[model samples]
Target: MEPDAPITIFGPDFPFAYDDWLTHPAGLGTVPDEALGTEVAIIGAGMAGMTAAYELMRMGLKPVVYEADRIGGRLRSEPFVEGEPEIAELGGMRFPISSRSFFHYVDTFGLRYSPFPNPLTEAAGSTVIDIGGQTLYARTLDDLPPIYREISEAWDSALERIAGFSGLQAAIAARDVTELKRRWNALVSQWDDRSFYDFLSTSTEFGSLTFRHRELFGQVGFGTGGWDSDFGNSMLEILRVVLTNCDTDQYLVVGGAEQVPHRLWTHAPQQITHWPAGTSLSSLHHGAPRAGVRSLRRLGPNRIEVTDRWGDTREFPAVIATCQAWLLSTEIDCDEALFSQDLWMALDRTRYMQSSKTFVMVDRPFWTDRDPVTGRDVLSMTLTDRLTRGTYLFDNGPDRPGVICLSYTWMSDSLKVLPHAVERRVELALAALRKIYPDLDIAEHIVGRPITVSWEDDPHFLGAFKGALPGHYRYNTRMYGHFHDQHTLPADEQGIFIAGDDVSFMPAWVEGAVQTGLNAVWGVMTHLGGRSHPDNPGPGDVYDALGPIDIGK
Candidate 1:
């Protein structure tokens, strides 16, 4: 951890208790040696690697996965208190239905889901927009200026049409960048130079309506602070995401988000080997005809050598590098130029926002303030300018009181250290609750302080996922371009294949990671005569099975 970095209860020096909790058996563990040298080698057991491994297994290929840390990478769920009815998620939470693939996977895996409570569920109906200390009234579309409202309504309608285009949907399903770009550009050109706020302001009849809409948009899209992002790009991306995931309907896994990966592993066969702890990949050596190719020695295209963390080197015909893109490009031996220089520059120009997930266990079922619109319990709340920005309230049922999980993203720049940051966040969350329910005293009702997880400082994932910048829309289509182009490496050669949300068709999210894994598998299969598992069909076949479903249809 950097000395000058912010302090939190979850930081390095905060004792290994939290670390121990994170690395528990349920967290992440290495596969035993007997499982080594399988058909494929997958590094990193996060969603991407795990999903890739699952897909590979479905294709009849059981790959050996190597993970330096716990499984589920950013999808962290831990017990706030031993013997509690439910565990708390310390990483990513709230999966929007807009992620069609993810939702399909959940359904296919037989996972259960339910809707999350709306934070505005309380009777104190007015939406509050707090900036610094001042609270402003939030306006709606009906309150907007006429001209701006008209344009916004028209633009929104147009966006909805673009999102529902069958070609765009097919392109996304196929992971075809060229096709997607052709469709996206055609749709985005309508408001190419306009900011979403500006468009809303100018297109509406009520300027106040535009301001209110921007305020809410700022809170949801870019935290509490108003976003300075390119409206055209952001709007298009948002619409595309909505259409892709079908977010008009949202759901949460009944057990928890972690259940998604658990199901994948459950579906895996027992014959698949799991490497034991302290086992290093360098110590293992394989002969020709291995399930997956291994690069061993530059000797005549048949062998290649791989050095593991323990300094042991072995040869293989092929290897899959399912690690972060930056790690795969620089740390592992690969063509640095596989990705366009502009892509790398764009990646460098972008920085992931830091987030700290804090899970709080409370004793009461507080639904006194029911939102008239959503009618669901307001378990989740987003604060405009506070240490704990978002909260997810889970109903533990009458038998057990509900638990509140508060997530704070983009906190690195606001605080000085991890410990202090967490403490301050807890204070703010408690204060916010008080503001929402003055009669409900938090200090007295508080069962435990929020347990925080800082993704920015974690060694495994240096940052959450790749974030986009103003002009980076071009690269959005290029995400995973290297993997899809089939030119990531020489035609006959194979080494490490990178897989993660950063290399997926969409932005950073669980669905992106899953898709990236599918893409990686395709790359690997293409290198091996298109031979995947005999019993299980590959992704291509899966796509074929889905048939040519039209998006708008």
Candidate 2:
């Protein structure tokens, strides 16, 4: 914990101190001598899968990783050209400092990062809000008209009125678990069935203002850009973001976001249980992870057989599936008998949100170049109701070429251009931006090919990340708590533990994936007859007594 780490993603759902557990002097745990070097199947090579694999290896267990596309998974960063440092973050960029668990690994490796250029933040020098064919430029909220400030105030007042915002945040900052759980558990029951729009539309503050206020609020959202896309999601989901400060104090990895997981894959802990000091996941598997998984079935009692895409099959004592739960039915040939009817239903009902991002590398940080007459930068971080919902500017340095996220959108906005190729996507983005910066010819500065991504279009990732809908609390609880409850399930079902951001209450954040992965580690250790140190108890050790609220179906 850094001095007074303002806020941590410490469970409003399951308040486990994963950050503390990771930094504890006492190691994770020790497996039995006989169980040492036992192979455990790890599906997916993303942050969640890699985190679990890294810890499992430190404990002297062999983690056989299966990656479908790339090792980084959603934490993907692609370069603009052959060897240039300027890169486009295809997925999982702009991480929050409150994501203590995810940063644990990043900080361990000393990965450099800078604050993200959010809508109104200092990192984004100036911001432009264009809506209804009108444009307003400002460096801060106060610089905007009174209406913008009113909208911001109303949101704060509404949160305090309806959710006890101050006290809730105070509890979290203070790390008061008892109060945090008591306040949060109550909120879960109240807001779980309610939608985010429902919270806004029904609030006394918002209700007092006109509908246009709500619209403006959506167009110019807090922390980042417009959150209108998440309007249909559960209020609990929205509250979690603000409560944990998930939307504020965000930073981007210097080299790339993918480096966190890639480094984890090859990281060698200072003190390992059964392996040599220099041992790492890369060394264990020779170099790269196994190809994607094709099928998963129970070979015998407490034994799971996994087949790779190329028809290579192997059985392991336990399997930690870090891939999206929805993929169990679609991408992999998972045996139906592996999970219970209720668990299967939860996995099936898990909804995902679509997302799209288009990026390009420019000759220089041209946005910083001021106009001769107006003395204003040529362009500013933009948020608009147009096709391009948000346009962010990234300045590498005077020496390196700057990168621009020409457009970033979600949900229906993303699906609008789902079928388009990268070139077509860039064209659409430019067409929309031209409306605001009509005089600026963005194409003149393009140095390399444009890069774009539509997660929904990708087979491996059917959607960006989990976004729970109203009345989906029961489903989230089932998926997240599965690691702890798996012990009571039937023999065949007990060993295959599920983990990922989708399996966590705080989905769409890397910390969610990291925390859930830690949970899976505890589940696997316990399943293999291992136990955590007495002083430092794992999540599973205290989960039954203090887990998520079970708001029954």
Q: How accurate is candidate 2 locally (lDDT)?
A: 0.91
Pairing residues by index, what is the TM-score of model 2? 0.99
Candidate 2 collision pairs = none
RMSD of 2: 1.2
Given candidate 2, what's the lDDT at residue 47? 96
Model 2: per-residue lDDT, tens digit, 1-553?
2466488788877788899899899977878898989999999999999999999999989999999889998999999886778889989999999999899999999899899999889999999999999988889998898888888999999999899998888888887778988998899889888999999999999999988999988887878888899999999999999999999999999989999999998888887889998999999999999999999999878889999999999999899999987789999999898998988999999999999999999999999988797788889999999998999999989988999999999999999888999899889999999989888888899888899999988889899998999999999888989988877888878899999999999889999999999999999998999999998899999898679887876
Worst 10 residues of 1 by lDDT: 7-16
Tens digit of per-residue lDDT, candidate 1, span 1-553: 2333221111000011222222233321222333333466676667777676765554444466555555666777676666564667766565665454566568867777776443333312233334456543322334323543454455455444434455555555554445665565555554333445554456433354545555545454321223423243345444444445433334556666776765665553332234333222222212111122122234335244555555555544444555555554444444444335655664445445555566677776564345566563343344455544455567667667556665455534323235556667677667765664444455554576557666666655656666544344455444444454444445344444556776653455666776667657666655444533434443333432222112230
Which portions of model 1 show Cα errors greater than 4 Å?
1-38, 82-85, 118-182, 188-213, 220-236, 245-247, 269-306, 312-316, 329-350, 367-383, 411-421, 432-436, 487-495, 531-553
Worst 10 residues of 2 by lDDT: 1-10
Off by over 4 Å in 2: 1-5
